[model samples]
Target: MTYAGVNRLLHWLMAALILGLLTLGYYMTYVADYGLYHLHKSVAVVVALLLLPRLVLRWFKPWQSTVKGKGAKAVHGFHWLLLVLLVIMVVSGAAYSGFGGYGIALFDWPLLAQNIDAQQQVVAHSAALSDWGLAVHIYCAWALCFTLAIHALAALKHHFIDRDGTLIRMLVGEKGARL
Candidate 1:
């Protein structure tokens, strides 16, 4: 497959996963059930694992050169920022949760650091870390959502007004010969 095709597939798939996980995390917090919370954490761990491989793939794959308009550059910058923030959010969240003496896992695989607390006070302290991580996670998620909205709108604009193949290159894997 072409670079654009791979990128498009990864983009949409990751978007769906992240959005679903975020929604579930938000809802799970309100419910006072340990099982539901475990489910949420499991989904988050999966997302983190998936994201790591996706990031590695992106690094190894060459990006198709797009039009170098100012708007396009800005959009690309926003995308890079979003990627970094997402990684931070995932790692911090996993660390925080694990440190709180809650070993969240998928099936039987533990995907985070093991908490070695010997006393309730240590667990309580770790819980505070979880709270801080949760706050940062929510903030990053909102920023990502806003960036996604802008990214979608920009693609629509290119498709309708610019009459360029910007959107098509990513969607259909047909890069325009000239930018």
Candidate 2:
């Protein structure tokens, strides 16, 4: 099966974005640098932007399956679950950052609503939303990290022990068929 070049590019690019944002988030929490916080927020905005197109592409151009076993189906199901969790993480993170009364922009272009605190009620509402969104974001990030480790190991198993093309199918466009 042929996976488009755009799909492979998006996959790797998003992987880098997620990994970078996760690291920045962890570091800035303790470092207490405004610059770091800004950087983290900036990376998150990029993640949010990439996520929209990635989700759309996933639906319109689904990845080809390389495994044929029952367990393979279960793994694919888990992958879909991971995708959902990723969206939750990205959205919650964006909401928390945007409502934290912080300024966020994509190369000087504002993405969120302006004058978010023009009304007293808006401030109160945003504060509440920020709290809950932050909590969910943190929890989901931890869960995602754990799941990512497991997923990586499983891919390695498929590549080495199982001698299958599961990992290859993701990293490359095609799986090598056995002769």
Candidate 3:
């Protein structure tokens, strides 16, 4: 089962990082300066990188799902959907950074850009790609936000109302979550 410690560790790490990204994304979009821009890019790049291994792990290792029978499909489907949205978000973010001319970096190392000149290092633009990238990034982010809300609600229902240990399985592991 993918419920091993490494998987849980990765899941929580990504969860915290993604949530931080969401908050940082919102703050940068509406309130702050370019100060956090590099931080945002750094974190995003890490998440993007981390996604691949997590995906591979999940794909190969069968999950011991807490859900059963009828409702399991929806829950499982939603889980996969979250991963799909993550891919979209990561791709679009990279597109925007690279094409939007803002560029990307893992903290300080530049990842994508045509030229790294003094005046036009990462600021060179390809108008179309930039705009499209930004549009998709923003829209998909909001869509992801709503989807996460629903996921959280369902988890809460399972834990608090249903007392079925679904949330426990998610937080811990399937075996550990058993009541």
Q: Write the per-residue lDDT of candidate 2 for residues 23-110, one digit (tens) a residue.
A: 8777776685657765676677787778787778878876656667896688778778778888898778777867765546664577
Error of 2 at 126 (Å): 2.3
Compute the lDDT of residue 62 as modeled in candidate 2: 68
Give the per-residue lDDT of model 3 (tens digit) for 117-144: 6865455477798788889999999999
Q: List the residue pairs that clash in candidate 1.
A: none
Please provide TM-scores, in order, for all candidate models, with all chains considered together.
0.74, 0.81, 0.88
Between prediction 2 and prediction 3, which has the larger lDDT?
3
Q: For model 2, state the Cα shift of residue 105 in Å.
A: 1.4
lDDT, residue 31, model 1: 66
On TM-score, the leading prediction is 3
What candidate 1 gets wrong by more than 4 Å, as runs, is 30-34, 60-62, 113-125, 175-179
Q: Each prediction's Cα RMSD?
A: 4.0, 3.7, 2.3
Ranking by TM-score: 3, 2, 1
